[model samples]
Each structure stands twice: as C-alpha cells, then as structure tokens.
Target chain A: MSLLGVENVTKRFGGLLAVDHVSFSVPEGAVFGLIGPNGAGKTTVFNLITGNYELDSGSVSFAGANITGKPTHRIVAMGIARTFQTIRLFSDMSVLENVLAGRHCRMRSGPVSAMLRLKWQRKEEREAIGKALAELRFVGLAAQAENPARNLSYGNQRLLEIARALASDPRLIILDEPAGGMNELETAALVNLIGRIRDRGITVLLIEHDMSLVMKACEQLVVLEYGKKIAEDEPDAVKQDPLVIEAYLGSGDEDF
Target chain B: MKPDADNIRKGAYAAVAVLWILAPLYLDKYWTDVLNNVAIYAALGLSLNIILGYGGMFHMGHAAFFAIGAYTTAIVNTAWGVPVLWLMPFAGIAAGVFAVAVARPIIHLRGDYLLIVTIGMVEIVRIALVNNVFGITGGANGIFGISSPSIFGRQINGVVAPGHYFYLLTVFLGATIILFSLLEHSRFGRALKFTCSDEVAATGSGINAAGYKLAAFVIGAVWAGMTGTLYAAKIGFISPESFSFWESVIMFMIVILGGSGSIPGVLLGAILIIGLPELFQGLQQYRLLIFGIVLVVMMIFRPQGILPPAPRKYPVDKLEKQEVSL
Candidate 1:
C-alpha cells in the first residue's frame, strides 16, 4: 500500500490556483522526487501536505490514515516529518540539542516529570540523547554536535537539519530542496545521505531542482509545472517526455 | 588543569554561599532588609525569565500574577485564618489559572503586539485590584493585620530582627534557583527554548509550540504568584501600589540587564536593579537619571547582559575529526 496519498488536492490564493487538482502516491520505502521550475507550485504542494496551508479541496492520507487539515505538529507526530525549503535550525541551540528537540514527539514525559526528574523521565531523556547522537553519527555530524547550529558551515547546517528530522523516527521524511545552496561535493554527499536514509526503510519524498541528485536517487519522479502535474513516471521516461522537456525548456527548445 | 578549575569554581560557590549565610550577622538591620529585597527581586526576575527569556514571549505583565498571589494569600488568610505559608501553593495555583485564562487568546500575538497586550493586561489587573472588584481586595487602602509566617512552629516576625527573615528568604531563593536550574536543562525547558528560537521549526519537529508557550506563561505566573505570597508575608500588607506597572517594568528590566535566559544573570540583574538603588539613597534626586544612564551605557557596551547565557552543551563520545571538515 502507498504510504502517502494526495488525492485531487487543489489550493488557490485569491484568483491564482497555486496547486490545481494534484494527485500522487508515494509507496513505502521508495525514494520519490517532485521536480518543477520556479513558481511551479512545488513548495506550495509541500506546504499543503504538511498542513502549513489550508487546502481549498482534496485530502492527504499517510499510512492509510486521513491526515488532511490536521495541525502541523499532529501530522508530524503521526509519522510524517519534513524540512523547510529554507534551513530553519534553532540557531541558538547546539547541534545535538536541535536533534534532541526533534525527539520531543516520541517522548512522553511532561513538565511535572521533567521538573521532578522522575526515573522514567530521566531514562527517556538519556535514550533520546543516545538516539540523537546516533542520528548525528549517521549524518557524520557527531564531532560537531556540541557546536552552535549557526556556527556550522552552510553545507553542515543542512546536514544538521536532516539529522534533526531523522531523530523524530518518522516512517516518511520529506526533503524540501535540501541541496539548495550545496556545491558539487556537498550535493554528492547529500545524495549518498539520502540513499542511506532510504536504506533504513524510511520512505523519502524530495522536492529538488538538482536534476543530477534527483535522477540519481529517486526511484520514481513527478514533474509539475504551473500548479499542474505535467508528467509522472520512471526518471528515464519522465526526463525524455516532450511535455517534461517543454515544461523545463519551453516550446522554443532553449537550453534549460 | 580541568580539575583545578573545577575546584576553584566550587570554592567560589562555597565562599559566596558562606557570605550569603553570614550577611545578616555582620550587616545592619537596614542593609539586611535591603539584601532580603534583592532576594525577592531575584526570584521574581527568574520567574519572568522563564517566559520572556526561554519562551521568547514579550511578557511585561508578571506583576499581575504577583498581585493575584498576594491577594489570594491576603484574602484566604484574613478570612479563614489560614497560615500564609500553607496558602502559598494556592496563591501560585490562582495566578497560574489566571494566566491560562488571560494568555490563551493573546499568546499568539508576537513581539510588540504581545507586548502592548500584556501592558494592557497588567493595567487591567491593577485597575481591578484598585476598584476592589468584589470588595475582597480592600480597595486602594490595602489590607493589613496580616499575621507573620511561621515555618515549622517558628514565627518569622519582620519586626523582631532581619536574621530569621534572611534565612527564610535565602531558603526560598535557593529553592527557586535549584528548581529553575533543573528545569532549565529539562525536556520541557528545551521545548520552550526551541519554540522561542523558531516556532515554525519547533512545530515541524512535532513540538506543540502554543502548548509550550502556554506552559511557560503559567509556570512563570505560578512562580511570580508564590513570590507574591512571600512579599505579602514579609511586608504583612499589600496595596494596589505594590503591584504597579512600574514593578512589572522593573522585573522586565531585571531579566534584560542580567542575561535574559541566564539564571545567574537574573540574580545579578536583580541585585543591580534592586540593591544598587538602595545603596545610592544619598543621590535621591539623580537616582532615576543614573539608572537611565547606566541602562543606556550597558545597552551600548554589553547588550547581551553582564553575564550572557552560555551555549548549551551535551556529552559526546570521543569527538572524531571527520573527512569533510567545516
């Protein structure tokens, strides 16, 4: 069964339909890619799925459970985690602390228990730290765990964000332009990290402008243009499709 | 070298603790009383830090909770003869409940908008108390005949001497510091910090941002309310003038001047804001001017506070130098 299903989703901002009748499904443990040009409503689709914006129509389901219009945090707790298109690390916090915060939904201890430091709360806290550390290690950020997030280089900051998202123990993780500011080497490392993330049996849904990374990592691809799905198929087929090519290069066949 | 540094720090803490304990014995009654006021202000500052510092809420109405607590204790004790100490927790609860009710709708307002709304809230509370809404507040004349607080069968009489009250205040201040320190490192505290840093990111991480903000508001309110109980018990009286908007402003200043989110910073801030004014009583006319100048100079030179909060750290296993260095 598909782990995520966005059926007939439509969103409008005044007169402009930001996302118009978009439908797609992401199978479990698969690496899926959504690619489009600037203002193609790619990020808007992410916002709608993550409940950052109210959809004008249609519904989203995760793990066969209807999750449309749920609060963003609640949707996250139900096993869907996402990163922002722009990196949003807790700038004042240490890298490990940022990851530890992502473990908040999985932990049960509240203020009272935390204040008193009950045995179970302490145990949970220790385990959370352990898991967060493991995530940092997975992303090769274990050494920089104590550094303030803002002090990390841009590429490392992006990795820190991914580490934070992975700490939530979600079944599905969405990457919104994770390679936005990355250079060639950094993008190559990010591709390897995404492949490793997929090998852990977590479904990956990515929105990227990096055709190289998307074509290399994603099992399937969805092409969007001007708030509509222009093509959906295997990367090879989608890349060759005239509609996808036209969407990217325009009718005049200019280089894109 | 690390062990030596640790020992020096420990020794410093011991010396400070010893000096605090011996203060009342060596000092005059007036000085001792002033020190006690410093402790009270420190507690209040720490309370406000939880909201304004950690939660990143622009809270300028903490005195309302303090007033609620004072009134709760005053009314409960005067009417039912309940000891002020016994009703202290009730005072905290009252303030906390009041905070939940008042902050629920307006907590979503950010920055200056929230600041304005909180300013209005404090005014509303003060006006309510002045008007003696239910006749229980005793109007602007205030309530009196309040008995002294007895802890473990020993009465703490303010008139007798400052020694016992000094010990009492110290105990309360120590407890507040310890509790706040523990909370500052707790999961809940981290949640509040994350919410403050980035509400959207915190929500994306599955943190209930609004819920944590509300928790911080109520916790700060409860602490302020408890401090109010202490203030009432110490003074044996409370008027609308005591919990004025000026008092709220002073509390806010204490957090900002002493690093907003730093516990030690807040304590130092309290001493400077509350204690220094008393020490400079000779320059009465220029008191406000000096304070304003000091604040401006401080803002210009060291805006983060005299003792800025240190970056939070966690224990790591053998720091490895990775291939791709930042």
Candidate 2:
C-alpha cells in the first residue's frame, strides 16, 4: 500500500472546479513531484492534500487513515507537514522561535505547565530547542538563528520555512515551490537540501516550476493541466509523454 | 549571537523588589501615598498592556471594564458589607465575564470598525453608571459612606495603616507582572503574536486565529478589571465620571509609550506618565497640554512605542554557526 494516497479527490470553488477527480498515490519513502503551469491547479492539489481545503468528492488517506476534512493543524499532528509557495515564517519572531512554533503540534505541556515552568516541561522545551537548532543548522541557518526571520535574505528565508516544517517532525513533507525565486546556484542548494530531507526517511511531495530541478530530483512525476491529471510516471517518460507536453504548450498557446 | 543581557537584568529586578518591599517602612504618609499611586498606575498600565500591546487590540472601552470592576467591588463591599479583599476577585470575574461576552461579537470587526464599537460600548457603560437604576446606585450623587477593607473583623486601613497598604499593593503588582510575563512567553502568547503580525499566516499555520484574539481580549479585560478593583480599594470611592473615554485613552497612551508589546517598557512608560504629572504639579493647568504634545512627538518619532519588540533568537547548530564565521 502507498504511504500517502489521494484517490479521486475533487475540489470546487463556487462555479469553478479547481481540482477535478485527481487520483494518485505516493509510495512509501518516494520523492514525487507535482508540476503544472499557472492556473493548472497544482497548488489546489497541495491544498486538498494538506487539508487547507476540503475535497468535494473522494478522500485522502495517510498511513491508511482518512484525513480528508481534518483541519490543517490536525493533519500536521497526524505527521503530515507542508511549506508554502510564499515563505510564511513568523517574521517578527527570531528564526529559532519560528521553528519552535512548528513544534506546537508535538508539545505535551498544557498552559499550566508552561505558566509554572515545571521541570518536566522545561526539560521538554530544552530538547525541542536542541532539535530546532539542529534543523536550522541542517538548513545552513544556525548562525542566523538570532536574527529576525524578516531580516534574512530571500534564499535563507526559504530554507527557514523548510526547517520550520521539519521541526514538526512529520513523516511526509510537502514543499510548495521550494525553489521559487531562487537563482540557479540557490536552486542547486535547495535540490540538495530536499534530498537530505528525503534521506532522513521522510517521504517528499514537491510542487515546483523549475523543470530542470524537478526532472533531476524527482524519481516520479505527476503532470496536472486545467484541474485534471494528464500523466503520471517516471520523470523521463512523463517528460516525453505527448499529452503532458500538449497540456503545457496548449495552455500557453490558448492564452494568446 | 551572545546570550541576551536582558536575562541577567531579570535577576537584578528581584533584588530591586527586595529593596522596594522594605523601603515603605522608612516612608512618611505623603511619600507612601505617592508610591501607592505608582503601584495603582502600574497595575493600570499592565492591564492596558495585555490588550493593546500583547493582544494587538485597539480598545477604546477598556475603561468600561475598569468601571465595571470598580463599581462591582464598591457596591458589594459597601451595601452588602463584603470584605474588601474578597470583593476584588469577584469584581474581576464580573468584569471579565462582561468582556468575554462583549468581545465575542465585537472582536469579529477589524481595525477602525472595532475601535468605533469599543468607543460606543464605553460610552454606553459610563452613561448607565451615571444614570443608575431606580436610585440604587445614587445616580450622579454616586455611592458614599463606603468603608475601608477589613481583616479579622478589624479595619485593615487602621491596622495595616498606609505602610501595610503599600505592601498589599506591592504583592498585587508583583503578581500581576509575573502573570503577564509568563503569558507573553507561552505557546498561547506566541499564537497571539502570530495573529497580530499576520492573521492569514497564523491561520495557515493551523493556529485558531480568531480564538487566540478572543483569548487575548478577554485576558486583557480581566487585567483591566483587576486593576479597577485595586483602584477602587485605594481610593475608597469611584464616580462614573472618573471612568470615561479619556481614562481609556490614558491607558492606551501608557501602553503605547512603553513600547506597545514590551513589559518593562510599559512599566517605565507608566512611571514617566504618572510620575511626570505629579512632579510638575506646579504646572498643573498646562500639564495636560504638555503631555499631549509630548505624546504626539513620541508617536511621530517612535511609533513602535518606547520599546518595540526585538527579534527573537534561536539556537544555532555547529554547521550553521561555522557557516556564519566563514
């Protein structure tokens, strides 16, 4: 059985169907890519999978449990975490605090424990801090930990967003445009970082525009066009698929 | 980054507390009264900080909660003869509950709409207090002959004297500061901060943004209510006229001056606000004019208030730390 499965999932916004009967499965420990041009409903799939929006029809099963209509936080608690296309670090907070917030779902202490600063809670906090620092260091941001997230350069901010998501300790991580706004050099670094994340035994579902990065990094690829899945297969094979190529070229041609 | 020196400063605060607690013994009644006023104002400033600073609520009706607390305690302790100390928390609960109810609906509105609603609410509460119901509240005459709080069937005002009241004030102020400090550092507090910074981002992070805002509002109301109770106890009387829109504005000013979200900044702002006026009693007529000008200038120059929130630091791992060095 697949580790995370989206079977016949559909999402409609008012009169428009944003995701139409999308069905796919992510095999355990697989590095999968979802790619589409603008308005092709790539993000809608991420939204549906992460429970940011409810599926109009069908279901999402993670670790063999349905999480279709669960709240985003509940999904996160169930070991599914995601980063945004727009890096949403807690900008006012320090880099470390932003990641610590991701640990919210994992925390065992109640308000009373935090308020009283109990020994057990303090110990747990120390451990959590150590982990957050480790994740930051892994993302090459350990020294920038004291800086406000807003002060970080764009590339570092993107990395910080990933570190924050990792702090939640999820089994499956979804990165939405992880290389958005990065130059070739930065994209190379992100490709390596995403691989490191997957090597830690976590499954990855990546939505990206950088075809080169996706083709090189993703073992499997799903091509989406106009709210429908046109093809799913090995990256090389999918790149050669006529229907997938047509969808990309067709949308661009039709726009004119 | 080096460890924050602020952490060490907190230790020094404890030593300062020890000294302040003992200094009242050497003070005369006049000085004791001034110190007492400071404690009361500090509590008031702390209360405002919870709402405007930490909660990011633009409340113009905080004085409504303050009025409710003061009246509840005064009415209960005077007419029904409840002991003064017992009256405080009960009054706080009454005001807190009122705030919770009011905030449920009002908090839905954002920005200027929320501000107008709060302003209207304060006006309504104040007018109701002034008008009274069937003469029970004495209307404009206000409740009179209120007694000082008592302990063990003896008047605390007499037994404890002004010096003991200072102790009580210290205890209350200390506890309030400690409680708010813990709240600012908690997960819930972080949720509130996220909401204040970006509501949409906070919601996307799986924080119940609306719920956190409501929590901050209610908590701020409770602080105001508790301070109101203290204010009534210290003065031994409260008039509806005293708890007006200006009173709420003054509270907002205190919070704004102290750097909207900084605890120590709020306390310092309160001292300057309350202290500056007292020290310049000679310029009493022009005092408010000068205060308003100073406030405007401060707003223009330091809009973040006395101490804007500083960026929080996270621990760095060995690799990233080395990367920075390179």
Candidate 3:
C-alpha cells in the first residue's frame, strides 16, 4: 500500500519551473529511488514533498490525509523526515546531542518540566538519551557519542544525519544523495542500512545519482528530466527506458 | 573531556560558588555594592545567553523587557503598596507576554534583520518610558520612592544601601544560576541550541525552529524582567536611563565575552564588565578606549570565548539498564 502520495505536484521559481507537474507515490515498506540527471528538479521534488518548498500547484497526501502547504516541522511530524544534499549537522553539538534533537518531535516534555526536572520529565529524558545512544550505535558512531559532530569524518557525518533523521521516528525516511562522496565500503553499508530501515517497517524514498547502488537497492525508481517525470518503473525496467537513457547520457539525436 | 578533568572543573566551580556566597563578609561596603551589581548583571547575562548563545539569535533589545519589568514593579508597588519581591513573578509575566507579542511578527527574520529589529524594540521601549506612555511612567524624571524588598518581616534595606541586599542579591543570583543551569541541560535547551546552530536541519529533524526561537526570546525576556524587579528594589528608583540601549549592549557583550552558552563564562563576564572599569577608575576619560582595546584583544585571542560550551556526556551503560527496566 502507498504510504505517501504526490499527485500533480508542481513548483516554480520566478520564471523557472523547478518541478513541473510531477507525480509519484512511495509504497509502504519499500525502498523507492528518485533518479534524474543534474538539474532535473529531483531535489526540488524532495523539497516539495517535505514541505521545505510550497507547491505551486498539486497536493501531497501522507497516511491517507492531504498535507499540502504544511510547515516543514509539521511535515516531519507527519512522518516525513529528510536530509540535505549537503550535510548540515549541528557541528558544535555533540554527536549524541545531535541525535537527541531528532527526538525533539517525539518527546512531549516542555520547558517547565525540563527546568523543574519533574518525575516524568526525568524518566523521559533518560529514555531519550538511551534511544539517542542506540541510534549512534546503529550508525556505528556509539564510541564518539560525546565528541563534537564536526570531529566526525565525512562518511560518519552522513551516517550521523541518517541516525538523526531516524530519531524523529518517521514512517518515511527521505535521503538525498546519501551515497555521494561515500567510498565503496560506505555505500555497501548504506545499502545494508537501507534494508535494515525497511525491515524496521519504515518506507524509504531516496534521491541518488549512484546507478549501481540504486539498481541494487531500490525496488522501484522514478526518473525525471527538466522538471518532468519521464519514467517510473522497477529499477531494471528504468535502466532500459529510452527516455531515461536520453536524459542521463545525452539527447540521442546528437549521437555523441 | 576526560572524567578527571570534568571533575576538576566542577570542583573549581563549587569552590568559586562557595567563595561568592561568603564574600560579603570580607569586602568593604563599597566593594559589596560592586558585588551586588555583578550578581545582578550575571543573572541578566544568563538570561540573554538563552537567546543569543543557546538559540543563536541576535537579540540586543533585552532592555525593553527589563524596562517593562521595572516599570511593572514600580507601578504595581507604588499604587498597591505590594512588597517589591512579590512583584517579580508579575514582572516576568508582563515581560514574557510582551515578548510574545513583539517577537511574533519578527521571529521569522533571520540574522542581522532580527538584531536590528530588537535594537529598535529597546529604543521604542525607552522612548515610551521617557514619554510617559499611559501616564503611569512619570515622564523623563522616572519613577521614585519605590519600596525595599522584605522577607518574612525582615527588610533588606535595599533603598540607597547595599547592606543585607548583598545576601538578597546572592540568593537571587543563586536561584537564577540553578534554574538557568537546569534549563540549559533540559530538552528545551537542546532543541533551542540545535535550532540556533542550523535551523534548516533542525526543522527537517521535526523541531519547530521559529517556535523555539520565539520561546528562547520570551524566556530570556522573562528572566530579564524578574531581574528588573531586583534592580528596582536595589536602587529604590528606576529611570529610563537605566534601561537604555547601552544597557542592552552591555548585556549582549556579557554573554559574548564570557562564552555564549557557558554559565561560568557569563559570571566571569559580569564580574569583569562591571568590576574592571570600577577597579581602573583612574583611567577616567580613556576608560572606554581601553575597554575597546580589551574587547579587540579578547576577540583575537579567544573567539570561541574563554570558556566555550563543552560536549555533553551521556551514560551509555544506562541503555542496557533502561531496556531491562522496560
């Protein structure tokens, strides 16, 4: 069953149509890939789904409810959490603190409870710390939980971002270029993590340029070209699609 | 940091705190007065640190809330004859409510825009006091003849003397430090810090960036407002001049100079900022010039502050225990 549905979605910037009437749905518990050439509005599409950008036209529904024009945090609370194309960890904060922040939406303790250290508040905080550390262990950065996030290597930072997103306890996790700048070993680990995330019953929607990883990990794929959806099918079928080939390789008319 | 180093740092903090609570006995009355001022400024600095330091907001109009609190105390006390200490909660509420109203429209602005707006807010508040808005402000001459705070029939004699007010001020400062420290370690504090460091990433992680920003602003305002009551009670008179834009600047500098989010840094900053010029009173006209040079030197030597916030440590061993309990 589809958990997130994007219908006739559109976004524009001044005169440029960043995402033009694109539509897609992410199935529940499936690893979905959003693939397109550079400047194909793949990131823009991600932004629209996560409510980072307002849709110029169209509606997005999650969990059987329309969620168009909601604020980014609200969208995240509705179980759609995403990472940036560029890593954006809270560099000065501890790695553990970074993950705890992801648990922000999940926890209900307020400023008063926090200040007074009320009975339930203390219990909640202790639990949050435990879960935050658990996420760090999941990302294999448990030993560095006390270190500043800036001290992490680039690959570890990517994992940290994932762990942070997962801390929000989202139903659908959106990863943008998670494998970018990763070594072969890191990519393999990410693929394994994606499978693990699915096993946890969370839907995965990712934007990727890594064809090998995408074909290997993603159950289905959506391809875009110049702000329009060109193809949507299984990874094997998408690889053989003529329109996707033209969009990624070159326009076939040029014969280069 | 190593556990031993953390323990040593914590021990040093305890020693300083003990010394601080006991210092009034040894110091002369004049120096005791200086200590009172230091305590008050330290509390105010900690208040602003929530917004400017933890929340990464550029708030320089904190004096507006301070002025509101002082005025609230003056008006309520002068009219109803209520005790000065009794009005602190009222002043904090007034400041907090006003902060919500003021910060609501402008909280979406990022960086320098927010800074400029807050600066304008302080000026507007000061001008309103000077103009005697609502006629209760007593115009440019300011409110006077305010009552001293009393505790269970024991008056501290805060009017025109530091005497027992030193103890009173220390108690206030101690409460402020403890409460603010609790807040700093709280979930609210973590979310605020994350939002400040990176709003986009924070929001994506399901944290409400604008709401937390406004909350930090209001929390800071509420604390500053309570401190205002203390200031008024200490002086027995409050004028528009006391809550000027310069006052706000000094509070901002206190947070930045000490270490934005470090409580100890703010206390040290309050000490140096209030105590240094008084100790170097012989500088006279060149005091500000020397102050500027000192600030420049500080910027070059310790940009992260002399005491930056340390990384938080959690007991990983607890995870095993937590699951078993569950």
Candidate 4:
C-alpha cells in the first residue's frame, strides 16, 4: 500500500516548466528517493507535493485522500512534513524551542488559552516539551537543547531539521537535500538516521544529490531529467539506467 | 531551565514589582504623572511588539488602532452616558475588526513597503477623524468631556490623585505583561516568530503564514485599543493631535529601543523615550537635540536594544533521555 501518491503532477514558473507531468508513489514505510541532476526539479516536486506551489495540472494524494491544491499547513496537518534544501532553523531561538515550534501544528491550544495558561494549554505544553526533547534526543542534540539553533554545527543543523520535521508527528517526511552540506562522516550518520527513521515505521521521501548515500539509504528511486520522470526502479536497477547516466554525466551533444 | 537562571529571573521580577508598587509613593505629582504616562506608552509598546517584533511586520500605523480605540471609548461614553470601563471590550473589538479588514489585503507586503502602507494607514485614520467622517468625532477639536473610569465605586482619575491613575495603569500593565509573557512561550507565538523569520520554511512546517500574521496584527490592535480606553478615561479628553504619526513612531521606537521582543526591554524603552527629555528638562533649549543624539548613539552602539529576549528555556531534565545512536 502506498502512503503518498503524486500523479502526473506539473508546475510551471511563468515561461519555464519547473516540474512536468511527474508521477510516482511511495509504498508504505519504504525509503523513496527523488533524484536527478541539479535543475531536474526534485525540489520543485517536493514543493508541489507539500503545497508550496500549486500544481499546474494533475493531483497529489496522501493516505487515500486527494490533497491537491490544499494549503501547506493543511498538507502538513495531513501527515506530510518537509525540510528545505537550505537549512531553515529558527535562528536566535533555542534548539528545543525550534522543535517545539514544529510541534505547533500538533498542539490545539489557541491564543486565548495560551495567554490564560489554561489547564489544557499547560498540559499540552508540558507534553509538547517532552516530545520535543525526545526528538532532540533522537537526533543526539538534547544536550544542546538550550542553545540557539543557529549555533548548531552544519551537520547538526541538518539533524535539527529532521528533528523539527519529526516533531510535527508526520507519517510521511520529505527531505530535500538532507545531506547537502554534510561531510562524508556526517552523510554516513545521516544514512543511518534515515534507516532509524524507516525502522520507526515512518515513510521517507528524500531528494539528494549524493549518489552513494541515495543508493545506500533509499530502497526505491525515481530519476528525473528536464522535468520528466525518466526512471523508477529499485536502487540497484536505477544505477544501471542509461537515461540517468546521460542526464548525470552528459550525452556529449551540447557545447560546453 | 537552569536553577541559577530561574532564580535570577525571579529576583528580577520581584525587584520590578517592588519598584512598580513603590514609585508613586516616593515621587511628587509631576513625576507620578510622568510615570503614569510612561506606563501607558509601555503597555502600547508591548502591544505593538507583537506585530513589529515577533511577527516581523513593520507596522508604523499602530496609532491608527490606538486612535480607533480612544475614539471608540470617547464617542460611546459621551453618547450613551456609559462608564468608560464598560466600553473597554467594545474599543478592543472595534480596533481588532478594523485591523483585520485593513491588514488582510496588505499583510503580504514585506518590510519597507508594509511600513509605508501602515504609515499611510495611520494618516488616513487621522484624516478621517479630523474630517469627522461619522460626525461623532468632533473634527479638528476632537471629543472632550469623556468620563474617568471608576473602580469599585471610587473614581480613578488623574485629577483627584495621579497615584490612583498610576496604580490603575500599572495593574493593567502587569496583566498585559503576564498575558503576553505566556503568549511569548505559547505555540502561536512560536509560529509567529517562525513565520517572521522565514515564511517559506514556516509554511512548509504547517504554519498558516498569512493567518498567523493577520492574527498577530489583530491581537496587537485589540490590546492597543484597550490601552486607548485607559488613555481616554485618564485624560477625559480626546483629540486628533494625540494619536499622531509621531505617537506611532515613539511606540515603534519603544519596542526596538528596549528590545523588540523582550517585555522588560519595552518597559525600559518607554522610560527612556518618555522620561529622558523630562529628566533633561533643565537643558530646555537643547533637550530635544540632546535626546536625538543620545538615541542615535544608543542605536549605533546597541543595535539589538538594551536587552534582546533571552533564548526560550525548556525543562529537558524532565525528559527521559536515551543515548543517541552512533
């Protein structure tokens, strides 16, 4: 059974087609990868699925519900959470507070309740703090929970983003370039982290440039080129696709 | 939260409480009146801090809401012979509803553009009042003979005793601080800060960026309106000149000068912005000039204000920790 399905999704930016008729589905609890060359629109697909951009055509569904054109927050509420290509931590806020902010969607207490410190709000707040800290502990940043988020190291910042996304209590988590600025060791740790996340019965949709990490971490892969889905297969089979090779290494037809 | 930090914060709170309660006793009538005035601005500053500080919306037209609130209280009190205190909620609602209408279309504009529009918003409101759009407003002369708020059958008026007004304003300020502090730590506040920092990331994280911004704008206006009610009752008069563009500027400066998101910073900001010139009254000719230079120097030296909000603290010790997998 699939948890998230993108059917013939398309997105255009004025004159340019950012994502074109891309279609794929992630099986429940599987690690799915969306990979292509830099401009192949992997991030755009993530944006479209997450409702950051309205699909120019087609539709997206999660958990058997058509969520096409829903607002980003609504998409998130329906068990989809994502990280940016560039790390977007709430800098100047404490690391724990950053995770708690992610937990904002899960908590239901409104402004009046919050201001009054109503019994229900306090209960939710206490539970939220516990969950946020647990997320930090999961990401190995519980010790730095009180420090400013921007004070985290590059690798830790990526981990922080994952923790933040997880704090939203999403069943499907999308990560865009989760290992973008990571070194080899950090990438190795991230691969292990993704495996841990998968072990916890959550589905992962990843957009990564690191081929080695993609192949090692993602069980299934969808390859894109020029906004078109060129390949979809197991990691081993995806490596053997000629179209993917040409897209990555070039076809030797264009003038450099 | 660490024990030591907690202790320090508690001590600071107690110290502020003592000072707030004891100040009017030691001060003369003029100084007490100054204290009351500063307290009003402090409340206004904290209210605007929601939009400008946490929401990161550059709203220079806060006085528009303040004006709406003051006028609401004044017009209603005069027309119906109702107690000003009874009209507080209406004043807040009027400003809040107006804020929603005006802010909805323009909330998406960024930084300087939003600032310019808000500036225009206040001017439009001021012009409306000056022209007596509804005829309830007394035009250029503005509304007068507004009643003082009575508390517990005892009249709370600046004329009978500035101390009574001081206590009333301080008590309200205390409530605002308490409620706002709780709000600062709440999910909504966190969401607003997130939206302010990065709308794209915040939206991606399941935050309604436009909704949160609009909510902050309205909440700020509601509080400002209530503060305006207090202002009307204290003065027993309202005028177009009172809620001017410069008043908005001063409120804006209070938030920034004290530390935009920090409550104590705003209080300190109100003191300096409203009290410094009075303190330097002996330099009658050069007081305004000296004040400007001091503010310029302060801004240059401490761009973040006197006390930017400390990072939020959470109880991590209570969480049952597990080892991070290598």
Task: Give the per-residue Cα lDDT of candidate 4 at A104.
Answer: 80
Q: Candidate 4 lDDT, tens digit per residue, B251-296? A: 9999988998888899889989997779878889998788788779
**TM per model?**
0.96, 0.88, 0.97, 0.96
Worst 10 residues of 3 chain A by lDDT: A247-256
Tens digits of per-residue lDDT for model 3, A175-220: 9999999999999999999999888888999999999999988999
- Candidate 2 residue-wise lDDT, B248-295, digit = tens: 787778888878888777877777787678888999899999998998
- Chain B TM per candidate, please? 0.94, 0.88, 0.96, 0.95
Worst 10 residues of 1 chain A by lDDT: A247-256
Clashes of each: 0, 1, 0, 1
Alpha-carbon local distance difference test for all models = 0.90, 0.80, 0.90, 0.91
Q: What TM-score number comes out for model 4?
A: 0.96
For model 3, what is the error of residue B156's alpha carbon versus the real structure, in angstroms, after optimal superposition?
1.2
Q: DockQ (C-alpha) of model 2?
A: 0.29
Pairs that collide, model 3: none
Q: Output the number of the TM-score-best candidate.
A: 3
- Per-residue lDDT of candidate 1, residues A181-237 (tens digit): 999999999999999999998999999988999999999999999999989999999
Query: Which scores greater on TM-score, model 1 or model 2?
Result: 1
State the TM-score, rounded to 2 decimals, of chain A in model 4. 0.97
Q: Give residue A95's error in model 1 in angstroms.
A: 1.0
What is the descending TM-score order? 3, 1, 4, 2
Q: What is the lDDT of residue B294 in candidate 2?
A: 91
In angstroms and one decimal each, the interface RMSD of every candidate reads 5.3, 5.4, 2.5, 3.5
- Poorly placed runs, candidate 3 (over 4 Å): B1-3, B159-161, B320-326
